[model samples]
Structure formats: C-alpha cells, structure tokens
Target: MSVTLKLATSLDGRIATAAGQSKWITGERSRAAVHQLRAEHDAVLVGAETALADDPELTVRLPGYAGRQPARVVLDSRQRLPTTAKLVQTAREIPTYLVATEAPQARLTDAGVRVLQAPALGEDRPELKAVLEALAREGLRRLFVEGGGQVAASFLRCGLVDAVEWFRAPIVIGGEGRPAIGALAVAGLADAPHFRRTEVRELGDDLWERYERI
Candidate 1:
C-alpha cells in the first residue's frame, strides 16, 4: 500500500502550542486542501492520541462535493477510541476501522467498527508493516496518514511513508511547542530518512509542501 503522511504545522515545525492546543493552525484553504487529499485516498488514519485528543471526524468535507468518504482508520493498539467520537457515531455510514494488538472490542464492533488485530512490537504497539498488510487485505491501497507526531515518526522510521504533504503556517512556535514529528534517533546524517521535494505552493497564509520518499 502507498502511504502519504500529512502534516499541518507552524513555521518552526510545531503542530500545536506548548499546552497542546492545535486547532486552526493552518487557514481555511489549507484545511480544504486536506479534505481534498482525503477524498483522493482510500482511507485516512491517525494515531490513538490524535483520536482521543482531537476527536476529529476524518471525513472529506468539501462544499457541494458528493463522493465516497474515505474509510477512517485509527492506530489504537489497545482499542482506546471512544464510541462517542464522531467517527464512531457515523461509522455505519462510513467505513471505520481500528487497528490494535489486542482482540476486537465488542462495543466498537457493535458500533460498526471493524477491528483488525496486528502483531505487537517490543513496546506492545501494533507492528506498522503488519498493520499496513492488514489494511491492504481490506482493499485500502492508498492510505493517508494524518498525524500527531508519534504516528508520523513511526511511518518515517519504518520507511513505510511513500510521500508527505506538509502545510506550514507563517506563525512561529518555539522549542516549547509540540513538534510535528517525534524523534527518530538519527545518529548520523546518512541514517536519516530522506525525501525529495516534489512541489511547493501557497495555500492561503500556509505554505503547502509535497515530497516523495528518496
């Protein structure tokens, strides 16, 4: 499966403030572009922290556009996603999946979520490659990974990310702010994951940058 990681951050690469308030980092145009990106993909995914923190719908919300809403997927190794979340509430209408290392939860399953069990890593997290394969088995070929740092870092660290769609706002948040990506423990320049910039353009006040894995 082809995985594209999306990032909406401040100029200094921060996704949120020091207190973790991340709403409206990018302008309206950038968000609309993100919805368009979601519509182009087969499924949209985010980590458990993102699900619990933001409680996003993960749906394509373009005006007057009537198309298939991309399947919503969450990397919740322990099945932490609440059934009250918007994604769960409207799951019967839109395909919703939860990837976990544990057995499927009945509450979520009854709420119309399909849980895919994956092998666990050393930290008890679902193995990335296994998760992708499971998702592929369900016919999700194009995966859009919208993140909250750890999720982005996981895909990058596993060399699973095929492309990146990054949106950067003009505002600056210093070191105290939350980073857009977590630490990869790159000890040398050669060990770092590299990407070739494919495109760059302005999306309102935010700059949208696209890159392909190198």
Candidate 2:
C-alpha cells in the first residue's frame, strides 16, 4: 500500500491563520487538484482535530465528477467524533470509518458507521502504524492523508509516507497558526526521511511541489 501525504500551507509554512481562519487559502486550481487526488485514492484520512475544526464534507465535488466519492477515514483516538459530523451523516452513502479504541467501537457501530478498534497509543490514542496496516489489509492501495499537521507528522516520522504534495500559498499568516508539519520526536538529522522532488507547478498564486520519498 502506498500512503501519500498532502497539505496546503502559506508561504511561511502556516496551515491556518492566527484566529484559525483557513478558508480559501489555496486557489481554485489547487482545490481542483485536491479533488482529483481524492477521486483517485481509495480513502481520505484526517485526524480528529481537522474533523472538528474544518467540518469538511470530504467528498470529490468537481464538475462532471459526480458519484465518485472516496471513503472517509477519521483518526479519532479517543472516539471524540461528533455524531452530527458530515462524515457520520453521509456514511451510509460514502462509507466513513472511525478508527478508535476498543471501547468506542460499539458506540460508533451503533451510530451506523463502521468502526475499527486498533491498539491504543496511550490511554485512548490509536497506534498510527497499526491503523495504516489495517487500512492496507482492507485493500486501501493508495491512501491519501489530508491533515492539520500532527497526522502528517506522524506518517512522516514513522517513515510511512511514500509521497508528498505540498502547496504553498502566496499569503502570509503570522504567529498563532499551526505549522505545515508538527513536531516529531527525533534524535537528530540522521533520522530525517529523504525526499526527491518530482514536480513543481504554479497554480495561480499558489505553488505546488510533489516529492517522492527516497
């Protein structure tokens, strides 16, 4: 299984504004590219923080692209996903999975969404590697990870990311915003993953960089 990490950030590497305002950060072209990637991937994954903050529909909504929606996967280690979330409400049609702890599986199943109980990272956090392996076993060949920083960092730190598509916007959001990549528990530079830049294209004011893990 190949896992691709995708993200859009400011020129200064900020994902959200100081006040958490993140709408329209990237232009239409970038958004269109994202939808195309979503349509190509088997499932789209995000962390609980992104789910709560964005409340995105997580569907491929490009013109002439109807009826092609990827399965939505949420990493809610503590099972903190809201019942009224768009993912849950549309699970019957698009299939949403809540990757959580063992205790929340029953509740999530009762809510009509498929639940996968994986090993906990701490008391409630789900192990990232285990969750990815399970998804791979379920025939998820191409995993697209869209995130709010921490999730992207987890995949990169674990050396599980096969490719990365990072978009750099023209705007500059100062401090008080979340970074493009969150902190990792690294000992030194020797632990860093090498990436070979594959492509760099400009979409209006945004710049998109594609890299393959080396």
Candidate 3:
C-alpha cells in the first residue's frame, strides 16, 4: 500500500493561523488540483482532531466530475468522531470508515459508519502499521492523507509515507501560526525523514512540490 501526504500550507509551512483558521490556505487552482488528487486515490484519511476541527466532506468536487468518490477514513482511537459529522452523515452513500481502539459506538454504527479496531500506541493513538493493514484489507491501497499536523507527523514517524504532495502558498503565517507538521522526535539532522524532490511547479499563487521517499 502507498500513502501520500498532502499539505496545503503557507510559505512558512503553517497550515493555519494561531486562532486555528485554515480555510483558503491556497488559491483556487491549487484547491481544484486537490480534488483531482482525491479522485486518483482509493481513500482519503485524516485524524479525529482534523475531522472534528474541519468537518471536511473529503469528496472529489471537480467541475462535472462523476467518478467514484474515494472512501473517507478517520483515525479516531476513542470513537470521538461525532455522529453528526459530515463523514458520518454521508457514510452510507460514500464508504466511511472509523479506525479506533475502542469497540464500535452504537451511534456511529447506526449512522452507517464501518468501525475498524487497531492497537493503540503513544498517547492512545491508533498504531499506523495496523491501521494501514486494515485499510489495505478493504482494498484501499492508494491512501491519501489530508492532515492537521499531528496526523502528518505520525505517518512520517512510522515511515508509512511513500510520497508527498505539498502545496505552498506565497504568503507566510509566521512562527505563531500552527505548523504543517508536528514533532517527529528527531534528535539530529540525520535522524529526520528525507524525501527527494521529484517535481515543482506553480499553481496560481501556490507552488506544488512533489517528493518521493529517498
């Protein structure tokens, strides 16, 4: 299975402002490109915190695009994803899966969400290896990770990320803003995860950088 992490952030690598506002980080063209990327992947995955904060539909919304929508998967270890969330509301129409350490919640299951269990790791987070295996069994081999920092870091830390599609805006959000990636516990430069830049181009005011794990 291959995992691609998508990041649409400011030039300073900030995904959002200090107040947690993240809408429209990139321009129209970049956003449209993301929709295309969604169509290419088998499933789009995010952490529970991102699902709670953004309430994203994770659907491909290109103009007049009638292709099969990718499945939406959320890493919600404690079953924290709300039943009222958009993913849950449209779970029956678009395959939505919730990976958690706990048993399936009645509300979520009744809402038509498929719950998968995975072993917990640090801070009770779902283990990445098992999560990927479970997803692979469901025939979701091409995974797209749309994140909110911690999720991106988790995949990098576990060496699960195969490629990266980074969209960088012209503006900078500065140090006070939220980072695009969280702590990876790299004690030295050599310990950091490295990726070889494969492509770079401009999409409107944003720069799309593609990288493969080296």
Candidate 4:
C-alpha cells in the first residue's frame, strides 16, 4: 500500500505556534483541498496528539460526499480515546479504527468502533510498519497520514512514507514554533531521509508541494 504524509505549515516550516495553536494555518482553499485528499484515500491516520488536540472528525466533510468518507484510524497505544470524541461518537456512520495494544476490544466494539492490536514503540506508540502491514492485510490500498509531527517523523524515518503533500502558507512562524515534520535523530546529512520534489502549485496563498521517495 502507498502512504502519503500530508501537513500544512508556515513559510518557516512551523505546523503550529510555540503554544500549540494550529487552527486555520492555511487558507480555505487549502483546507478544502485536504478534504478532497482524504476522500481519495482508503484510510486516513493520525497520532494520538492530533486526536487529543483537535478532536477532529477526520471524515470527508465535502458536500454530498459524506458517504464516501474513508476509514478513520488513530495510533493511540494506551486506548485513551474518550467516547465523547467525534470519531468515537460517530463511529457507526464512518468506520473508526483505533490502533492500540491489548485494548478492551469488547468495550470499543460495543461503542461501534473497531480495534487493531499491535506492538508498542517507545513508551506508548505503535510500530508504524506493523500497523501499515495490518491495514494492508485488511485490503486497504492507500493510506493517508494527516499529521501532528511525531507521527510524520516516525513514518519518514522508517522509510515508510511513499510521498509527501506538504503545504506552506505565506506567513512565517519563527523557529520557536513547532515544525511541520518532527525531529529525526540522524547522525549526519547522508543518513537523513530524502524525497524528490515532483510538483508544486499555488493553492490560494499557500504553496502546495508533492514529493516522492528518491
């Protein structure tokens, strides 16, 4: 399965301010474009931080396309998702999958959500490649990762990212702000992951770029 990592940042590559303020970083056109990208994928995944911070629906919000919403997946190893979250509340409408380890499968299913058990990474995150392979076995052909940084970095560091659709707004957020892609502890430049720029376009006042793994 092909994986696309998508994120919008400021001109200086900040996804959010130093205080974690991230709403409306880009223009309306760019946000709408993201919904269109979500509709094209089989499943859209994000890390627990994004889920906690945004409480996002992660569904295709485009008009008249509600039924085509892809599966919503979250990498929440501890199963900390609250039932009040939009994804959990509307689990019946759109398929919501929680990737966790040894979670209460019965309880989650009772709430109309599916659970995928996997091995943990670091303190409380699932291994990305295993999660991807599990999704592939379930017949998911395309996975889109709409991020909150650390997840994006994990995928990129593991060489699991097939492409990136990065959007840069005209405004600049200083270095104190949170970066678009989180840190990867590469010892040198040669060890760092690289991608070949494939396309660039202006979406409203934002710069939208596409890149493929070199």
Candidate 5:
C-alpha cells in the first residue's frame, strides 16, 4: 500500500496560528481539491492532536459528493481519543477506526469505534511502519495522511510517504504556529528522500505542488 501525505500550509510554512486556530488557511479552490483527493483515497489518517483541535468530520463535502465518504482513521497511541469527538458522532455511514496501544483498546471499543492495538514506537506512540503494515493487511490500498505536523514528520522519517501534495497559501502566520512539516532529526539534504515534482497549479491565491517519490 502507498501512503500520500497531504498538507495545506502558509507561504511562511505555518499550518496553524499560534493558538492552534487553523480555519480557512487555504483558498476555496484548494479546499475543494482536498475533498476531491479524499474521494479518491481509501482511508484518511489523522493524529489525535488534530482530532482534538480541529474536530473534523473527515468526510467529502464537495458539491455533488453527497454519498462519497472515506473511512476516517485516528492515530491515538495512548487511546486519548475523545468519545465526544465529531469524528465519532458524525461518522454514521463511514467507519471510524482508532489505532492505539493495548491499554486503551477496550475503552475505545466500548465507545463504538473499532480499536486496533499495534506495536508502539515508545511507551504510548504507535510505530509508523507497524501501523501501515497492519492497515495494508486490512486491504487499505491508498492511505491519505492529513495532519497537524508531527504525524506527517513521523511518516516521512519512516520512509512510508510515497507522495506529497502541498497547498501553499499566500498568507503568513508568524510566531509559534506549527510548521508545514514538523521537526525531525534529518541529517542533511542528501539524507532526504528524492522527490520529483509531478504537478503544480494555482488554486486561486494558493499554489498547489504535487510531488512523487523518485
């Protein structure tokens, strides 16, 4: 299975404001394009932080896309997913899965979401490669990772990201906001995986850049 990492960031490389306010960072065209991408993917993966901060329903909401919805997946290593989250309540048709450690598995299962315990990287963090392999075994062909930053970095560090679709808005959010790609211990540019720019387009004021692993 191939995983595509998708993100919308400001020209200054910020994804959210200092206070985690990330509403309407990209233009309408870019947002619409995201919905189309969601329609193409088998599953959408997000971190627990994004779930708690954004409360996104993770459904395809573009016009004429009424019935199309992908499975919403949450990477909650410690089982920190909130029962009252919109991802749980609004996901009536589409299935929602919570991937966490064994400690929180039962509680999440009791909350009506399917829970899976995978090998953890640390005490409470799920190993990226293990989680991807588990998802692949479950027949998830194409995985779309939409994140707040840390999740994206982890996938890239693990060499699990096969493609990247980045939408760069023309605004700048300075100070203490999250970066386009979170901090990683990458040594140098030579250590970075090679990527070939496959597509570039102007979505209103935002510039969408699509890259494929080379």
Candidate 6:
C-alpha cells in the first residue's frame, strides 16, 4: 500500500499556534483541494491528538460527490478515543476504524467502530508499518495520512510515506508556534529525508507542493 502524508502550514513551518488553534490556516481553496485529495484515497487517517483537537468528520464534503467516501482511521494507541467523537458517532454510516495497541474500547466498539489491535512502537505508540499492513489487508491500498505533527513524523521516520502533499501559506506564525513536523534526529545533512518535487500549484495565497520519495 502507498501512503501519502498531507499537511497545511505557515511559511515558518508552523501548523498551529501555541494553544493549538489551527482553524483557517489555509484558505477556502486549500480546504476544498484537501477534500479532492481525500476523495482520491482509499482511506483518511489522523492521530489521536488530531481526532481529539479537530474533531474532523473526514468525509468528502464537495457537491455532487455522491460516490463512496474513504474509510476514516485513527491511530489511538492507548484506546483513548472518545466514544462521543464524530468518527465514532458516524461509524455506522461511514466506515471508521480505531487502531490501538491496548484493549479495545467497548463503548466505541458498541457504537460500530472497528477497533484494531496492533504492535506498539516507541513509548507505546502504534507502529505505522503494522497499521498499514492491517489497512492493506482490508483493501485500503491508497492511504491519505492527514496529520498532527507527531503522526507525520512517525510515518516519515519509519520510511512508510510514499509521497507528501504540503501546502504552505504566505504568512508566518512566529513566537512559540507549533511546528508542522516534530523532532527528527539527524547528525549531519545526509541524514535528512529527500524528495523529488513532482508538482507545484498555487491555492489562493497558499502554495501546494507535491513530492515523491527519491
């Protein structure tokens, strides 16, 4: 299965303010384009922090998109996913999955969410490779990993990301802002991950850069 990681951030590489206020970082065009991207993938995934903070519906919202929406998946390693989350509430209507390392949450399972158990990574986080294998077994061949920084970093660090779609807004979020990607250990310049730019387009005041692994 191929995994594509997508994120929208400021010119300073910050995805949110210090307080986690991330709404409206990119314009309407970028938001609409994200829906299109979601439509092209077999599943849309987010980390537990994103599920809790954003409460995203993770469904195609475009007009005349009556086709089947992609499955929604969450990497909640500890099974802390709330039963009242929108993903859980609408699981029966649209397929929703919770990948965890610990025991399944009964309330969420009773609410029609597919709870998956997998191997743990560093600090009890769900390993991305196992999650991808689980997803692929269910026929989710193309994955769209929409993020909170830690999730993206995990996949990239594991060398599981096949491509990246990063949208950069014009403005800069200075002063203690949250970075788009978390810490990556590197001793020298050769340790950085490199990508070949495939395409670049303007989305309102934002610039969307698409890159493939090199």
Strongest candidate by lDDT? 3
lDDT per residue as tens, model 6, 75-97 = 99887778778899999999999
Off by over 4 Å in 2: 105-107
Residues 1-214 of candidate 3 have per-residue lDDT tens digits of 9999999999999999999988888999999999999999999999999999989999999989999999999999999888789999999999999999988899999999999999999899999999999999999999999997999999999999999999999998899999999999999999999999999999987899999999
For residue 180, model 4's alpha carbon misses the true position, in angstroms, by 1.7
Higher-ranked by lDDT: 2 or 6? 6
lDDT by residue for model 4 (149-188), tens? 8889999888998999988899988999998888899999
Clashing residue pairs in candidate 6 (N, C-alpha, C atoms within 3 angstroms):
none
lDDT values for all models:
0.94, 0.86, 0.95, 0.88, 0.85, 0.91
Q: What TM-score fits each model?
A: 0.98, 0.94, 0.99, 0.95, 0.94, 0.97
Candidates 1 and 3, the one with greater lDDT: 3
lDDT tens digits by residue: candidate 2, 7-90: 899888898876788887899999999999999999999999999888888999899887668889999877788778888878
lDDT of 1 by residue, 36-58 (tens): 99999999999999999999999
TM-score of 4: 0.95
Clash counts for the predictions, in order? 0, 0, 0, 0, 0, 0
Kindly provide the TM-score of model 5 when superposed on the true structure, using C-alpha atoms.
0.94
Decide which is better by TM-score, 3 or 4. 3
Per-residue lDDT value at 76 in model 6? 92
Better of 3 and 6 by lDDT: 3
Put down candidate 5 lDDT per residue, 1-214, tens digits, no spaces: 8899998999888999887778889989999999999999989999999998888898898877666578888998777777788877754556788888675555456666877678878557888877877787777889999996989988888888899999999998985887868867879999887789999999999999999998
User: Model 5, stretches more than 4 Å misplaced?
Assistant: none
Model 3 shows how many backbone clashes?
A: 0
